[model samples]
Target: MNTPELGWFKSSYSSAQGDDCVEVAVTEQSVHVRDSKDVTRRPFTMDLNGWAQFVTSLGSN
Candidate 1:
């Protein structure tokens, strides 16, 4: 994906200390996730439905 044009943002829950930082970019069709500390690494992508399922599962746990 052409990441440069994406509006990547860190979670509001992330700490100012910068540890465990994750960045996410949402598009109409997919959601992009990556480590904020290492933008050079490839990001993980999932369809919007899958992303919603993942978030829902997190709440269940």
Candidate 2:
């Protein structure tokens, strides 16, 4: 299946210098994650539940 085009946004925590930048796009079924500095690479896809868990886990660190 073709991935849907989404409006990706850079994380607010990303550096102003543009290094280690992370971008995310939300869709109906999943969230797409990619490196802002390397858009040519395939993105990592996660379901809503997985995405929630991942974000929650990050908050605990």
| CA lDDT, every model vs. true structure | 0.89, 0.84
What's the distance in Å from true for residue 55, model 1?
0.2
Residue pairs in steric clash, candidate 1?
A: none
Give per-model TM-scores: 0.86, 0.78
Please give the lDDT score at residue 4 for candidate 2: 42
lDDT of 1 by residue, 17-59 (tens): 8768999999999999998777888899999999999999999
Regions of candidate 2 where Cα sits further than 4 Å from its true position: 1-4, 17-19
All-Cα superposition RMSD per candidate: 1.7, 2.9
**lDDT of model 2 at position 19:** 77
- Judge candidate 1 at residue 48 and give its lDDT: 99
As for candidate 2, its clashing pairs are none
